[model samples]
Target: MAFYLVTGGAGFIGSHIVEKLVRRKEKVRILDNFSTGKRENIAPFLEKIELIEGDIRDSGTVTKAVKGVDYILHQAALPSVPRSIKDPVTTNEVNVLGTLNILMAAKELGVKKVVYASSSSVYGETPQLPKMEDMQPSPLSPYALSKL
Candidate 1:
């Protein structure tokens, strides 16, 4: 069975991904700070998986969690735009730096693949028709910049 390390697995989107993974019979581990993610989101599968309550900013914690995992679904980030604007430092720490930490851990652990969830706000307010991956990026908020 492939092991999946899901960061931010207690948050809105992460929990759903984790639930689906659990149902597929995959060995799953969750890494969450619980800053905005709720315990209730992950309560349904508490007994079927491994839980690591820690922030992604802490290298030791993230590294330990990523160890032996074959795949990574990095979902840990400060999601709210207003929240990021209110606290850019924390937002950058959790979003950008935390992502770097996970990437490094994945490299060290020789993980097969690392998947990231990036938003489509990079194009800003331009009246562009189709949003393509190669388009120029325009970040309006710290949240958008972090996701970039």
Candidate 2:
């Protein structure tokens, strides 16, 4: 079985990923500070998966979390355009710097892959139904900029 480390695994999207992984009987680990993620989301699977309650910004915590994990599904971030606009510093710290920490840890630990969960808002408001990967990012808010 593949070992997967999902940051923010208690959040909406992350929780779903955790559920699918558990269903498939994969070894899963989660690191979340619960700033935005709710306990109820992950409560059901607490005994099934290993969970580390910590922030991604903390290097020691991230370092400890990354150990022995093969793939990292980087889903942790301060996710809100309006919230980012309100607190750009926090947003950048959590979304950008926090992600950098994860990437650095993953790289140093020799992780096989790191799949980042990027926002479609990076493409801005266009008539396009499906935004292509080649499309240029036109971020309107700090949140969008961080995602870019």
For each candidate, the alpha-carbon lDDT, in order, equals 0.93, 0.94
TM-scores of all predicted structures: 0.93, 0.97
Candidate 1: residue 22 lDDT (0-100) = 99
Q: 40-116 in candidate 2: lDDT tens per residue?
A: 99999889999999999998999999999999999999999999998999999999999999999999999999999
lDDT of 1: 0.93
lDDT of 1 by residue, 1-148 (tens): 9999999999999999999999999999999989889999999998999999999999999999999999999999888889988999998998999999999999998999999988777677778778888989998999999999
Model 1, residue 129: C-alpha shift (Å) = 6.5
- Error at 141, model 1, angstroms: 0.6
